[model samples]
Target: MSRHILPPKAGHPDVICAAVGWDRPLQTYYAQVCFRTDDEPDEGEALIWRGTEPGELPTPEAAIAVITPYAEIPPRLAEQLLADMTATIGEKDGRHQAEVKRRLFGSIH
Candidate 1:
């Protein structure tokens, strides 16, 4: 399982944090948006949305699509999250590893 903890954004003060990642064993992507509790800011976190259904989100992109509406993160941050999630999966897939290397080093003639 690969998890990324998104930094808190100023625009969304009530949002404590957002977690997005992939579960290798389940072969599913998941996301969780957490909010600060009303009574206690530091006490605990409230889950506003969660996408953990097996087979629901087959790809990291699909998970991001479902999470976008709720998370409300900046475009750059969202892109970074997607890249991070994909990298996690790439580590497990040989094809993806080669693709990553190509992107990083270009085609070696």
Candidate 2:
């Protein structure tokens, strides 16, 4: 799926980046953001954010990823998706964080 990672602008149509997110088994969604740096031929590997929502990730450094179906997503759908994902994947327990991180990093970005 093609996802647009938009700049944090209230009313901007053009997008500067793109992203892709997938649901993991450990009750988390890993999102990847990719963009062209310096607006040249060189492209850099962007950040991968593990979050459930937009406001849930208030900090930009923490990852404000814009993934598919989320470019124009609403708060209600985001909550529902997160709930369903959590219900399916269960909880975020230890002994799995490392595995999850490894898997997410490998698959995302």
Candidate 3:
């Protein structure tokens, strides 16, 4: 599994983290939004939302795109997610970049 931990957004204080990753055995990607209160440190994070019904997303970037709305990640973070994906996959493949941008932004600007 390849996991990227995204920090909470200021506007959404309850959100603690957003995790996006790939499941190699399942050959798919997944994303989860988690929350945790200061008092609940021992209890661990709680799941707020999850995306990409098993085996749905083919790439890590797609998983990021699917989770961005619910996680409310900033555009800069989203760009970083793309960059991380590029690093993992190696090289900035135009096809993947275009597809991820289209999915995340509704258009490749």
Q: How well does each candidate superpose onto the true structure, as a TM-score?
A: 0.56, 0.33, 0.51
lDDT, candidate 1, 1-109, per-residue tens = 7777665655777777777776653456777777778676864374644444445566667666655655655556557645655665544435764575467546311
Better of 2 and 3 by lDDT: 3
**Whole-model lDDT, model 3:** 0.60
Tens digits of lDDT, candidate 3, 2-84? 67777765687667677776644334567777766677753337564344344567655677776675465555654554555
Candidate 1: segments with Cα more than 4 A from true spot: 69-109
In model 3, where do residues sit more than 4 Å from their true spots?
37-44, 49-54, 70-109
Of the pair 1 and 3, which is ahead by TM-score?
A: 1
In each prediction, how many residue pairs overlap at the backbone (N, C-alpha, C within less than 3 A)? 0, 0, 0
lDDT of 2 by residue, 2-96 (tens): 12243323332233444433244333344554444555334544543455532343322223244542244344544544554445454443566
- Relative to the true structure, how large is the alpha-carbon lDDT of every model? 0.61, 0.41, 0.60
How does candidate 1 fare on TM-score? 0.56
Off by over 4 Å in 2: 1-15, 18-22, 38-44, 51-73, 83-109
